[model samples]
Target: MSPTPQERRAARHQFGTGSDTPAARRGPSGGRKKPITVDAIVDTAFGIVEREGYEALTMRRVANALETGPSSLYAHVVNKEDLDELLIGRLCAEIDLPEPDPACWRQQIVSVCTQLRDQYLRYPGISQAAFAAAPSSVDTLRVGEGLLAILIAGGIEPQPAAWAVDSLSLYVNAYSLEVSLANRRISGSDDNWVVSRGELLRRFAALPETFPHTKRHAAELTAGTVRDRFDFTIGLLIDGLPGARRQP
Candidate 1:
């Protein structure tokens, strides 16, 4: 069965994805009002991104959505950077916390990475914040901690495990950012994606004549869907980890 709306809201709060607004905000009529809150501000920011696209998300846009001035938002939100970090934390928290299974660390890593990508993609342009402020958030640190523990349990040294977490998280964040931008440009999945993809391929195939190799195997270069590419990249990292395992 589908979750009740209230249940979903509860989950968001638990995951830091939604705010507990202090009651409904009153319209300009002033009969009743929900005080503008940090959570509400973040929620409004997400709504603006969903409607106008991620690039259009800003404190002013959120203020406009909430029917308040941008300065009012400052009362709840420090600035755009702070808002981005909160967004990142919310996205990261949405991922299922991985269990450190000694025998299945590789699978755990892949599972964690895939879940993270799915959640981060829900908020386009937000994962880019991962590069700047994610480490400071509890959610991001939780993911890193789980992965590091699993790495150590699997016979990997502390230093290598640390680097792996850094490298793996970066890879997922960068890949999601690229895909989010591409999705915006494609304007939803349909003929537009096909046409845009075809155009990209055509450019590559056309250049193969000059570059030789590019023309020879353009199809191979663009063979996979986003999911396929993500899985393959993740597989490479997991499969290669043993080579870097520390000597006892």
Candidate 2:
């Protein structure tokens, strides 16, 4: 059965709020085993993600990390989907949203995106969960609400502001996922397929006449640090917003 609104609220309060549930005074095995709470589950999941990447995260893996069984995880988390939402919610809760300043709204949005990017990159492919997580997660909604407030304060109409938030979120997720995949490829043993910028340039330059423009503009294509490209793309998105104020 689906959880009621009140049940959902209680669950969010129990899991999403960062507070840990109390450990039992004793264990069933007559040994001192740490209680398995939502916090412990999330912490264990993050450890798995950090050490082995998000692809390695699973109920069984988290259970093993907690020295418990997968069935034990169901007591706190609903399933893999629920756990994904919790992970994203936890990351969103870490974002520090600023007060809306019309003169600085653009920079504020950029800062939010940068914060989310850093968070996603930290877990390496965990943004995949963000893509699938339900939008109703309270912590995720908090970040969206913060972004909407900033955009509206900057003179954006309600509809465009809402859509802008979605676009910005999609871009951040896609960008972070790409970077994570690239990093994984570069770090793997069969990384010969992942070439340095110089090698990329050489490949572009070596292409036949069929790719004239790509060959001619190889340097420009390969230019800029990842951050430079990140800032550039975000700037483009922010500047394109109707009625976006440009500060001197």
Writing each residue's lDDT as its tens digit, candidate 2 over 139-159 gives 998999999999998888899
What are the C-alpha RMSDs, in order, of all predicted structures?
Answer: 7.5, 3.2
Who wins the lDDT comparison? 2
- lDDT, candidates in the order shown: 0.71, 0.84
Per-prediction TM-score: 0.78, 0.90
Question: Over the stretch 1-248, how does candidate 1's per-residue lDDT look in tens digits?
Answer: 53433443444435643443333344573335457776787788777766766788878788777776776666545578777777776677677866676677777788888888887788786677677454755666677888888787777778877888888898999998898888787776655544555787888876735688777777887787889999998877766775443322
Collision pairs in model 1: 24-34, 25-33, 25-34, 26-32, 26-33, 208-215
Cα error, candidate 2, residue 87 (Å): 0.8
Which parts of model 2 are misplaced by more than 4 Å?
A: 1-10, 13-31
* Candidate 1 stretches greater than 4 Å from native: 1-31, 188-205, 208-210, 242-248
Best model per TM-score: 2
